[model samples]
Each structure stands twice: as structure tokens, then as C-alpha cells.
Target: MKGKIIFFSVFFLLTTGAISAQAKNAPRSIISTTALIRKYHDQKELSGMQKGELLELYIERIKVLVKTLPYIALVTKPGVTMADLGIPDDSEHKKSLENQALGTSTFLDTTVDFQRKMMPYSDKANLIAAILFYEGTLKSLHEFNELNEM
Candidate 1:
């Protein structure tokens, strides 16, 4: 019984330590374009111009995602007023929403272009990690906006 208890305690501590390490190494909430460009260049052997183009694509994608999130949330959530969702009830908001949606759609279309261009050269694991991080960021943003309405 004593041996079993010690084994379990050691196992639990090791498991928790591994989890904590992984959580610590996870990326920050905001993606840095410069850092990403440097990483792409270093990891993928991308030329300066290629890195610049990739960074531009990334920035454009993120801009669309961030800009559309509030509008998307507003459109989806019932009983939530635009004001409550941080959207103004004006032509400006409508124009912004329209532009953001269009831009986000265009960004999604370019995902294939980016993948075809970079997937062969890029570190697959790093690319996947970056994608997951961005997805998590978007999820967090939506959840935060939703909670604010409550």
C-alpha cells in the first residue's frame, strides 16, 4: 500500500509538471508580425521578400478576423443589442461589417494560396501550432465578447 501511494504521488507530480510546462510554452494571445516573419525566415529558409509577403498576408488575415468578430457575434447572438455588443447602430458600423466580412472571406480564400506556397517549405509542426494559436485567439475573443453581453 505504501509503495502504491508513493508511485501514485510521483506519477501525479510528473503529470502536473508536464502540463504546466506545456501551458507555459504556449504562444501569447497576440501574434507578432515581426516575430512571425523572423521565424518564417529562419525555419522555412524563406527569402526576405517571401517573409515580407507572408507577414503581409498574416497581418491582413488577422485584421479581418479581429475586425469581423464583434460584428459576427452581434449578428449571431439573439436579444443582444448592437450597443451591448459594442457596435454602433449607424451606417459606419454597417460599412465596417460589410468590409470586414468581405475581407475575411478573401483571407479564407488565400489560405489555400498560402498553404500551397509555404507548406512544402515550412515546418509542418510550427505551421500547425501557429494555426491552432490563431484559432484559439479567435475563440477566446468571441467568448469574451459573449460574456461581456451577459
Candidate 2:
């Protein structure tokens, strides 16, 4: 009986430690397009921030949709396009762009809402970190877009 209890206690401790480690290393919460816009206004490089926020928001949104949408088989099939994510490809890229923008905006709004709710409980540093990350992500995306365009 004593041996069993010791084994169980050790197993519990190891499992809890592993869970704690994973939780700590998990990626930060997703950033939204609106949050990116706010960050852009807060910083001098508006375009860079805008791009980063948009890309990150899109990727995260895609991940969620892929998980929840049953009909989205191509999501994991590889070599998918915006159309796979419900963006229609037609004459002009306008429609696709619009859909992307709307999706990103919605994602950002959700993030902002969550941030506001946690404001009273979370540390200021966490909020700041989140903002910085969003801005940084936008900056990187902007650079990549510029390169592709060039």
C-alpha cells in the first residue's frame, strides 16, 4: 500500500510538472486586427504594424477555423489558398482582400475584448508585452510583403 501511494504521488508530481512547463511555453494569446491598428497608432511605423497584425490574425484565424469547420478538408491537405479558407477567387482580388480584412478585424476585436476583461486582474507588463508582440509581428509581415512586392 505504501509503495503504491509513493508511485502515485511521484507520477502525479511528474505529470503536473510537465503540464506546468507546457503551459508556460505555450504561445501568447492571438492578436486581432483592431489591436494591431491601435498599436500602429501608438507607434511611428503604422504600415509595418498593420501588416504584421493582419498576417498573424489571419494565421490564427485560419487555425481556429480549420479546427472547428468540418467541411474544410483542404485546411490540412497542404497547398491551400485563401479560397480554401472561404475567400472566393474571382475577377478582381478585391473580394478576397475584403474577406481577409473583415476576418482579421473580427479576430482583433475578440482579442481586445478579452484584454479588456482581464485588465483588472492581469499585470500591466503582460498587456504591454502583448502590444509589443502584436506590433513586432506586424513589422515582420510588412517587411515580407514589401519584399514580395518588389
Could you give the C-alpha RMSD of every candidate to the true structure, in order shown?
14.9, 18.1
Q: Point out the worst 10-residue segment of candidate 1 by lDDT.
A: 29-38
Model 2 lDDT vs. the true structure? Answer: 0.47
Once model 2 is optimally superposed onto the true structure by TM-score, how far is the C-alpha of residue 131 displaced, in angstroms? 1.2
TM for candidate 1 is 0.35
Which candidate number maximizes TM-score? Answer: 1
How would you encode candidate 1's per-residue C-alpha lDDT over 1-150 as one tens digit per residue? 999999999999999999999976543221122212123223333233453454554554455454445444344332344465565557676566456557655866687567657665765454544544565665566587687769
Residues 1-150 of candidate 2: C-alpha lDDT, one tens digit per residue: 999999999999999999999976543222222122322434333334444354444334334332223322323222344554565455355454455556756765686566445554644444445555655655555565466556
Number of backbone collisions per candidate: 0, 4
Could you tell me how far off, in angstroms, the CA of residue 136 lies in candidate 2 after the best superposition?
0.7
